[model samples]
Target chain A: MLKHTPFHDFHVQQGAKLVDFAGWEMPLLYRSILDEHEQTRKSGSIFDVSHMGRLHFSGKDAVTFLNKVLTRNISEQKAGQSRYSLVCNESGGVMDDVIISRDVKNWILVCNASNREKLVKHFTKVRHDLDLDFDMSDQTEGTAMVALQGPKVIERVAGVLPVDIKALKRYQFESGSYMGMLKFTIFRSGYTGEDGVEVIIPAKIAGMAIKLIAGKTDKPDATIKPAGLGARDTLRLEAGMPLYGHELTQTIDPLSAGLGWAVDLNKDFIGVEPLRKIQADGPKRRLVGLELEGQRIARQGTPVLLNGQPIGEVTSGTMSPTLQKSIAMAYVDAAHATEGTTLAADLKGTQVPAKVVKLPFYKRAQ
Target chain B: MLRKKAMPDAPKDYRYLESHEWHKREADGTITLGITQIAADELTDITYVALPKVGDTVTANQRWGDIESVKATSDLYTGVSGTIAAVNNELTKNPGLVNSDPYNAGWMIKIKPSNAGEFDKLLSMDDYRKKTGH
Candidate 1:
């Protein structure tokens, strides 16, 4: 049986096309993928991100335990600030990419929905092996998450939220209670390359919270319409963000995936040694962006060819709604991973000409 | 319990395959072929349509072409064996027409069917709706 999020019924009411995502029955699209994508780019859209794992940590050893496992130095993180980080195995391969936030009293970690259970087990084992004394609890089922993302999101959301979310810089967060009843945390962060806030509220008050935040207008042309996982994937791909299962797998290292900035080589983490070696020797293959000639999408595992020989494989591809072109991310031989280099994607037997481009296919204007 | 989805209107005079292709027999004895609205909705945001060349032979229940969306790809099949009379070139540049207007402007091909009796073998509007659980 598939698990349903707190907003499952809300999705159904909005005429969402529901699909199984990471063992959860989630909305693929509320109206249509293209419509929602355009809506997010142009105005604002609300995304149900409740399926993602939310773990809280407390106790004296919390910072120490996090510093031992996470790629980033968690001890340096300030209260109400979030930092993007990665969890790597002993071999320096990425386990999951996550966001670690230092709240006022406790620490919060948001990870991919698919990696939640595995991560909980891994954290537990690590704590036991290290004989640490932190209280780690998975708060996913007890809370709900919603991301209101787009250029217009901040202004409108600021009117309803208790705190002045517009004043919060990127990666900053604030906690407050609505109507002195519904307690929530608003994080000025999102997966989509847009200015927005992700709000977490108690699971029981999800329906009431959405109503309060989005307002009473539920028309199709409402400023904040409900988008789904489909638009979220496309938006992130356009933003050049690497997804856990697609780009950062168990065998793929963060350095090779062009995420070295998130890894701290100076810190003593679980995978720091191998990562240091990888940084010294350089990555064998580097992740690069590709713009195909036409609308033919180079799907995952499609071979990227140079001079008719396979050089790499595509990780993710989409006919970008924002760019109106076929864009993909692939790991190519480091020698050929330069902007404007010509390559081809072997779709079945046909070769579609591709050109290496910059990582992000779309960027919002400041 | 999931709510029953209302079936998109399938023309009474047209015949449909379980795979979602619809065939309409024209007055000129040619059959116009296109995917049903259900197929278009399922394959959201179609990005490309690869149709067989004009005058190419298409076999019954065989793959004639391919249609691509942002997230998935599906092979196009025909219910009637025929010579490709004409293919819609507009779909190459604007495949979204398939989703917006699947019946008329989105018609993929017009085939000069070899066996006219094949149309009768296809499912009627009522049967197709029942089979698809509308």
Candidate 2:
């Protein structure tokens, strides 16, 4: 049986097409993928991200333990700051990409749902092996998360939320209590390439919190509409974000996934040595963005060819609703990973023309 | 039990395959084929329809072309074996017609069926509705 998030009933009432994602029965789309995608790009969309794993860390040893495990150096991260980082095995291959936040009293790590169990086991094993003393709790089941993303999101939420969301810079977070009862954390970060905030609330009060923030679902002119995993996937793909199972896996290292900025090579961590070696020798393959000539999508495992010879494979792809172009992210050999390089995606038996471009296919106006 | 969502009815004269392809027998004895509304709804935001050219041979229950959406790809099939007499060229430019008008302007192909008896072998409107849980 698949697990259900706190907003499951809300999704049903909205006529969502529910599907199993990472063992959680989640909404894939409420109305149509295109409509939701457009809504997110134009206004704002509330995404039920409660299925993601939310792990809390406390105790004096928490900082030391996280610095040793995470690729990003978090010792200098001040309270109310969040950083996107990756957890890697000893060999520097990514186990999962996560967003680690430094709260006033504790630290929060939001990880991929598919890797939640595996990461819990990995972190536990590491802590036991090292004999470190820290309080780690899986708050995923007790808490719910939602991301309200778009250009208009901050303004729409300004009146409902207590904190000065406009003052919270990107990657900053603040904890607040609503109605003198409901405690929550709002982080100005999101997966979509838009300005927005991700809020975490108590699981039992999620339905009420969403209604308060998003306004009535029946409102025809509501600022934020409910989007599902379908639009989320497409929106992230257009933004050139690397998904865990698609772009980052146990065998794919951070250097090759174009996540070098997130890794602190100078600091001590579980995967630092191998990452330093990879940096010194240079990565064999690098992730690059591809814009295809036609609307045909280059799905995962599609062969990326350079003059009829396979050089790499597509990891994630979609017909970008915003751009109206077929775009994909692929891992190509370092030699052919230039921005203007031309490649072909072998879709079944046909070769479709593709061109390597910059990482993000779309960027919002500043 | 969860409430079953209502689905649009398949045309009374049409026959359907379990995969959701609908077939209509035209006055010329040729069979016109397209995906049912359920299939179109399932594969939302149809981006491209890879249609076979005229004169192409399509075997019953075999994959002829591919229908791609923003999220997934599905193989288009027919219940009747036939030679492709006409193809929906308009879909090449606007594949979303499949979702907007699955029964009318979105008709995929017109085929000269090698065996007209195959159409009668497909599921009727009521059976198709039952099979789809509508």
Candidate 3:
């Protein structure tokens, strides 16, 4: 049986095409994929992201334990601030990417839902060895997450929330009452490379909050069409962000994925030695972005060719709605990963010509 | 951001195929062919349509061209074997027409059929609907 979120009924009412995603019935799109993609790029768009895992940790020793387990230095994470981080196995292989936020009273480690159970087990192992006096609890079931993203996000969400959201900078959060009743937490962060805030509230009031923000009029009817998982994939791909299962996995390290900046070498964390040794030996292959000539998209696992020989494979790709061109992210041989390098992607037995460009194929206007 | 309108039933004037292409016998012994409305809705937001050249010979139940959307790409198969007489040049710049007016302006090609009796073997509108389970 597939699980349903608090807003499942809301999605049905909006004429969304529902599909089973990660064992959960989720909306794939409301009207059309192109419409939703264009709307988010031009104005604003809302998304239901309640599938993520939210873990709470507190106590004097919480900070010390998290710093030892995560890739980023947690001691530098100030109150009300969030930092992008990662967790790795002993081999320096990426387990999962996370966001560690220090709330007003506790610390929250947000992870991908598909990796929740594995991460929970990874966290449980830390308790047996360390003398840390903290407790780890999963708050994912009790809470719901919604992301409002775009250039007009702050201007549109301002009318719904009670506080001035403009005062909050990136990677900051604050707890407040939603419409003067339900307690909520709003984070000025999102996966899409757009100005937005992620709102977390109790599961019961999640539908009401979505109605308030997405409803066309003052009534509770949800007239505003919501974006689905398809648009979410394209949005993140256009932003050049990494997906856990795609660009990151048990055999892929963060350094080879071009995410080494997030790892703090000064701190002694799990997998530090393997990371240092890999750095000394250099990565065999590196991830790079490629721009195809036309609308023919190269899908995941498509072999990337350099001079008629396979070099690597594409991890994620899409016809970028913002760029109006075919673009992809792939791990190519270190010698062929440089910018301006010409390459070919074997798309359905046809070697379509491509070019190794910069990481991001599209960036929003300032 | 063109919104998809509620698709109507397949026009009875043309014969449908299980692969979703529709073709009709023209008065001059040639035939006009395009995709069905159900196929259009399945491939939403058509961005590019790659049709064969004017003189190309298309075999029955075989892949000849391609259509692409924002998220995926699909091969286009024709149910009738014919020599292409005319191609829809307008679809080069406007492929979404294949989704909006799939039966008319979105028509892909006009072909000179190798066997005119092939249209009788194609699926009727009622049979097509049942095959698609629409």
- TM-score for each of the candidates: 0.97, 0.97, 0.92
List lDDT for all candidates, in order: 0.91, 0.93, 0.84
Candidate 3 at A239: error in angstroms?
0.9
Local accuracy of candidate 2 as per-residue lDDT tens digits, A8-68: 9999998888999999999998878988888888999999999999999999789999999
DockQ of each: 0.47, 0.49, 0.40
For residue A156, give model 3's deviation from the true position in Å: 1.9
**Using lDDT as the measure, which candidate wins?**
2
Backbone clash numbers for all candidates listed = 0, 0, 0
Superposed model 2: Cα runs more than 4 Å off: B1-5, B130-134
Order of all candidates by DockQ, from best down to worst?
2, 1, 3
What does candidate 1's lDDT look like per residue over A86-121, in tens digits?
999999998899999999999999999999999999
Q: Can you write out model 3's per-residue Cα lDDT over A241-325, one digit (the tens) per residue?
A: 9998999998899989998989987889989999998888888889999998877888889999988999999999887778888
Q: Model 2: what TM-score?
A: 0.97
Global CA lDDT of candidate 2, please?
0.93
Error (Å) of candidate 2 at residue B13 is 1.9
**Each predicted model: what fraction of the native A–B Cα contacts (within 8 Å) does it retain?**
0.46, 0.54, 0.50
Model 1 residue A357 distance off true place after TM-score fit, in angstroms:
0.4
